[model samples]
Structure formats: structure tokens, C-alpha cells
Target: MVLKNILHHRFFENFLKYRYLLTELVKRDIKVRYRRSVLGIFWSFLEPLLFMIVLTIIFSTLFSRSIENYPVFLLSGRLVFMYFSQSTNGAMRSIKMNSPILKKLYVPKYIYTIALTLSALVTFLLSLIVLVMVMLATGAPFTPYIALFIVPTVLLTVFNIGVGLILATINVFFRDMEHLYGVFLTLLMYSSAIFFPPDVIPVDFQWILTWNPVYAMISLTRDLFLYGQMFDTFTLIFATISAIASLVIGLVLFYKYQDKFILHV
Candidate 1:
């Protein structure tokens, strides 16, 4: 009874009322992203492939022995990290970038950030085609476990939305957050073990990767896609908890500060 009531709540009703608007916003974001570019959407397929090729060329010899099918390993991790970086960055800037619309009309503010993340997700899904091509070219095994890749993808999306909300709210108040987040992302990319093998790090530092939610998602992808096995129990649990916590905190903060957004923007 309680669950049914919650499902029919006014908030959900409002969301449904604005569903069309959300769809349009997502389409606009994707279109804007590829506007004036020659290759356009194909870049989604090519960008990650090019990145994988360059990174593999440079690091293949270094970790080739330690990591089997180094290209597949590299590409899998890279895709996850790329999605995370792009989605969060887009979400962070969604508010200010659309300030004109926000000021002119009354719409759900969260819709802007959600639209950015969803647009990024669309590109990320399309990029997975490149990952498939690389896997086939490299002769990486295709296993049933690959179907479970959705688990981490969904979790990561939730986590992105949560973080996006927090960043969008803060970004409205502090324009400097955009610059600071760029530096933070650089540090995060290094710490994520994207280009390097985590095993190379000392045992003492293993905790760093273990505790990182983004690394957890990346490692989960590698496990399913490259290793042909189930993800670690701890990783799944940690990722779920981290994602939920982020969303809860983000909602709390976003709603609390959302009214003030009009003042700043």
C-alpha cells in the first residue's frame, strides 16, 4: 500500500508530465554535442578506438606480460572511465550552460543535469561498439558474463547522476568548481589504474583503488568483459552502497540549495 502510494506521488506525476520535455532536452544536448563536426556521432566510435590504440602502443610492452590481452583490458577500463568523466562533466555544466532557459521558464532544474548524463550515456553505449570490435580483433573471449555488464553500467549511471546533482548545485554557486573538478578528474584518472595495472602498485596502496567507487565500476567491467568471470562480491556491494549514498546526499543537497540557484544564476 505504501509503495503504491509513493509510486503515485505528485513528484512522480510531475516527472511524467515533464517526460516529453526531458526527451527533448536529451535530444538537444546530443545534437549540440555533434553540431558543426564533420564526423559527428562517428566520433563516439572512433575517439575511444583511437585512444585505445595510442595507449596500447605506448604501454603494451610495459604491462603485456603482466596483463593478458592488454588491449581488451585497456579498452574496457577506458570506456568505463570515459563515460564517468564525460557524464559528470556534462552534468556539472548543464545548469550554467542552460541558464537562459532556466531564467526564462519554470522547469524542473534537475532535468538539465539528468539530460546531460543521459546524453553522455547514449554516446557511451554507442562507443561500446568500438569495444566489441577491439575485442573481436584481439580475439578476447566472449562469455555469458558479458551480459551482466549492465549491472555495473546501471550502478555507474546512478552514481553519475548523484555526483552530477552535487556538482551542478555547487557549480551554480561557485564557477571555480568547473576548474577544480578538471584537476580532480585528472588525479582521479591516474588513481583509477586506467592505463596501468593495479597489481603493479604496492599492496599497501591497493586500498586506494579498492575504496574508489569509479575504480570499482571499472574493475567490474574488466571482470565481466575481459576476464570472463563474475565480479567480486565486495566490489558489487561497495559500488551499490556508494551509488545509493551519493544519490541520497545529492538529493538532500540539491533540493536544499535549488531555490537559491535562481539568485545566483
Candidate 2:
């Protein structure tokens, strides 16, 4: 019942009404991001490729014997983490940066954040192609399990939008939130099993990975794409619930404070 009410809310109605506008905004964001760049869209493909090289070199030297298909494992986590980090960070600045558009037109505020996030999603998808190429280059098998890749990809996208909403809302009031978030992302990256396996971390502190949303996301993707491991129902449920909860709370908070945004920005 409560969910039905939320679905019919005025804000959501306006969001749907302005759906075309949102699409335009997303297109503009992508074009603007690569506006003057020489490489343009190819930069998206290059970023993950470069990171895969650097991380593979450093981590492989440390744990290559212990971990098979280390490059595939590292690249999968790196690309997903980069998507979340980049999406939230871009959405964080969307409102303030586009204050002119907000002030001039009376559109749903959430559209900006949504557009920014979708733009990042586009880039993330592009970067994922690099991961696929690396997997082939490294002779990783294409098992039937690989078909399940969409499950975690969709979950992670939802998680990114949720986190983006929260960050965009907070950054409106406190600009320093992005700076703090950057530092936090650094900690998250190192601790989330991006380059190293969880076993390397002290067993006592491994719970960090156990409870981490991003780690769960990365691990799930790796399990399907690289390891051919069976899915863990508990982990899937936990991660899905976390993503939905974040989206709901974020939407509620953003809706509550949305009216006040124009005044501040």
C-alpha cells in the first residue's frame, strides 16, 4: 500500500511527465563530458584498460601464484567501483553546477541527478567492454554462468542511483561532502577486495568485506564473470535489499528537501 502511494506521488508523476526532458539532459551530459576531448568516447574504453594494466601489474606480482585469472578479477572490481564512484561524484555536483537550468525552468530536481547518473552508467557500460576484451585476451572461459552477469549489473546500477541521490542531496547543503566522500572511496577501494582477495586481510577484520555494499557488488560480478562460482542466495538478497532501501530512503530525503534546494543553490 505504501509503495503504491509512493508510485503515485506528484513528484513521481512529474518525473514521468518530464521523462523526455530527462533523456535530453542525459544526452547533453554525455556530449558535454567529451565535448572538446580528442579521444571523445574512446576515453571511456581506455580508462578501465589502463586501470586493469596498472592494478594487474602491481597485484599480480604480489599474489599471482595464489590467485588465478588475477587480471579479470581485478578489472571487474575496478570497473564496477569506478562506476559507483564516478556516478555519485558527478551527481553530487549536478544541481549546483546546473543551477542556471534549475533557476530558469521549473523541472523536477531529481532529473538532474538521474541524468548525471545515467550518463555515468553509459560510460560504465563502455568501460565494461574493455573488461570483456580482457577476459577473452586472458583466455577466461565463457561459461553458462556468465549469462547471469545482468543480475549484478542491474543491482549495481540501482545502488549507484541510490547513492547518487543521497550524495546529490547532501552536497547541496554541504559542499565539503564530496571531499570527504573522495577519501572514504579511497578507503572503500582498498578494503573492498578490488585488487587483493579477502583472505589476505586479517580474518578478524574481514567482516568489512562481508558488510560492504560495493564489495558485495564486486564479488557477485566476479563470481559470475571470472570464477564460475555458484550464486549465494543470502548475498544476493542482502545486496538487493540494501540497494532498494538506499533508493527508497534517498528518494524520500531528496523529495523532502527538494523544495528548499532552489533557495540554497
Top TM-score prediction, candidate number? 1
How much does candidate 1 score in TM-score? 0.98
Local accuracy by lDDT, each model: 0.91, 0.87
**TM-score for each of the candidates:** 0.98, 0.95
Name the lDDT value of residue 123 in candidate 1.
Answer: 89
Q: 1-265, model 1: which lDDT tens digit per residue?
A: 9999989986588789999998999999899889979999998998889998998999999998889988888888888998999999999999999998889899889988889999889988998889899999999899999999899989999999999999999999999999999999999999899989998879988998999999999999999988999989999999999999988888789989988888898
Deviating ranges (above 4 Å) for candidate 2? 1-7
Candidate 2 lDDT by residue in tens digits, 1-265: 9999989988779988999998898899999889989999999988778878887877797888778999898889988898889888898898898998788988888889989888888888788888889989999988889888888889988888888889989998998998999999899988898888779999899888889999888888888888887678878988899899889888988988998898888
Worst 10 residues of 1 by lDDT: 9-18
Clashing pairs in 2: none
Model 1 CA deviation exceeding 4 Å by range: none
